[model samples]
Target: MRVILALLLMAGMARAGSDRPGDFDYYVMALSWSPSWCALEGDARGAAQCDPRRGHGFVLHGLWPQHETGWPAWCDSDARAPSRSEIRAMVPIMGSAGLVRYQWEKHGRCSGLAAGAYFDAARRAWTRVRRPAALRQPDRPARLAPAEVERAFLAANPGWTADMVTITCKNGHIQEARICLTKDLAPRPCGADVVRDCRARAARMPPVR
Candidate 1:
């Protein structure tokens, strides 16, 4: 991915504030806190991941490329949409076909690889991060500090440090955990601003139904 950025820059096609394909330094893998999403969706339950029987835990929100300043979006308008089989395979993590499609059109299009290769890379990146045991669907609601959440992740995933993570929250509820990785998928430090976004001393992690 870093090579893609360099090539685009050399061609002078990637400029500041432009959504050029492959214009990014590293990646941020967002792991959504499913219970928080279910709580927000309320009784709608229209998405497959929201089904109570599924017992979903930390789910993939996206594998996004990041710039030191601001990230790019919708880089390749002409990129082909992913097939039904590809979309279905991501449903276990991404929740819906519509979301899968949207993510590919926006983030994946900028990845320089074709749709299939992009999603395949996403799956590989998602699997690289080990989900912390405590955050994996406890029977009761889990109330924790932001530091504790970061610690759990660092302890579970070898070589992951505090600088490599960003915990997002709403009303003191954990909404997501965004982890930074190198273009080659190795753990790396996130931007300082991203790390400071969620500073809540205490947060609630709704129980997975």
Candidate 2:
């Protein structure tokens, strides 16, 4: 009986964090504000995305695999890593090849896709959402409520509703906009854990370079 109970406990533990590939419920496509990232950590690291010439606005952060109540990360997969050329190709949209590789190892691996297909899916997900053009062209810094950001996104993307998106902040600066999507790339309502919108009355938005 003792041995049987121990085996059962081990089985439950194995299912907890979900390291298996291709075994998740949905995706959260995170779009990071390039300016905010630069202000926060990218500039210090001399990240190429922080270069003024890049003029990046919202860049693809990652497409994360989420369970109904939790998330999976760093899943074990047999897929090969993305090639240098492939990584470089994604830089215009994702800001960094390093980030591309990291996202693949972490979240993309859980998508049950090869590196190329995973990246393609991420690209498709990004293309489906219409980023607010007004926010992209801001010539000066501004403070915006988190709801205002969500409203802008909802206005730009017709099918997206309030529960489908959330705006996150870091260090008083607008951070990332996270949107929930089905495996087929259609917008969906976020899970409870994914709907934690920033409570800040106003968050700083640095202007595009």
Candidate 3:
């Protein structure tokens, strides 16, 4: 009886550990503000993103598949890292090679696609959204309310309502904009927990370098 009970417990534990890809309801496409990321990465500025010549604006951070409460990460067993070519392909959009590898290991593993296909999906999601012109040409540093920022994004991308996106900030600086998508990559409303407005009344946007 003791042996049988132990086997039952092991089976239950195995079932609890079984989270696979395609188990998510939606995805959140995160786009980082390059200048904000550069500022945040302070002495560690050697990243390609920190270089002014990169001419980066909102760069792909990652396309994270999210559950309502928590998220599934590092789901795949093979756990193969992204290749050099895969890293190179993402550099233009993702900014740095190290970030590319990290994103794959953390988020892409749970994406149900190989590294290449995962990045391809990331690119597809990146291209699907439009960056607001105001954000693109912030020649001088400016402060804008989070609602204003969301409006700019909504204006640029028709059909994306306020509930579909959220702005993230760090120390009064706009950091990233996260937009939720259906599994098929169409714009969708983010859950109440995921779409909170920035706490600050206004957030600064550093001038593009």
Candidate 4:
């Protein structure tokens, strides 16, 4: 009897471990965000892994450019950005049309309206950090460097200039940064060598007037 109980307990644990709740969401989202043939070699491509289970696709490339190193890679994994479409898809449909039925059938009530609402709000809030295509001119890659970009932004925004700049470059691409802004939340470039004043300004933006 003891051995049987132990076997049953072990089996239950294994099932729980292997059955990750969000795997379908990850894969489906990856398809949405990544290029059509992104799985060419089976390695996760670009920033897809950040939303490894499900990606917002190239739509997010401009919003959060991929850095080849550091924790920034997992920024989306924390649920910072979920595509609006992905949010709509998750509650009603999971892996595919087929998954809609499967998720409902299997778990009976795992992730329901609550999870859907949570991810949806996350998607909306992400738009603030999301860089619009108009803002990012990737075609002018040759002429643009992160530092120069910061200066230009400073000029454009007046108060919100680049306060710090940390360039995460690999394969000749500067990935992302930790920007500080003026009291009005005007953006400035900031990084490791950035000054305390910039950090202070960024840290304490004036309330919206």
Q: After superposition, how far is residue 41 of candidate 4 from its true place, in Å?
A: 11
* Best candidate (score: lDDT): 2
Better of 1 and 2 by TM-score: 2
Estimate the TM-score of every prediction: 0.87, 0.91, 0.87, 0.30
The all-Cα superposition gives candidate 4 an RMSD in Å to the true structure of 15.7
Residue 101 lDDT in model 1?
Answer: 89
For candidate 2, write residues 1-209 as lDDT tens digits: 99999999765643455768888898999999999999999999999999999999999999998888778878888889898877987899999888998999988888888888888998999998999989987889999999999999999999778999999999999999999999998999998878999999999999999
> What RMSD, rounded to one decimal, does every model reach?
7.1, 5.5, 7.1, 15.7
Clash pairs (backbone) in predicted model 1: none
- Backbone clashes in candidate 3 total 0
Segments in model 4 whose C-alpha atoms lie over 4 Å from true places = 1-126, 129-141, 153-161, 164-167, 180-209
How far does residue 23 in candidate 3 sit from its true spot (Å)?
1.8
Which runs in model 1 stand beyond 4 Å of their true positions? 1-17
Alpha-carbon deviation at 147 in model 3, angstroms: 1.3
Candidate 1 similarity to native, TM-score: 0.87
| Local accuracy of candidate 3 as per-residue lDDT tens digits, 149-200 | 8889999999888999999899888888999998789999997668897878
**Highest TM-score scorer:** 2
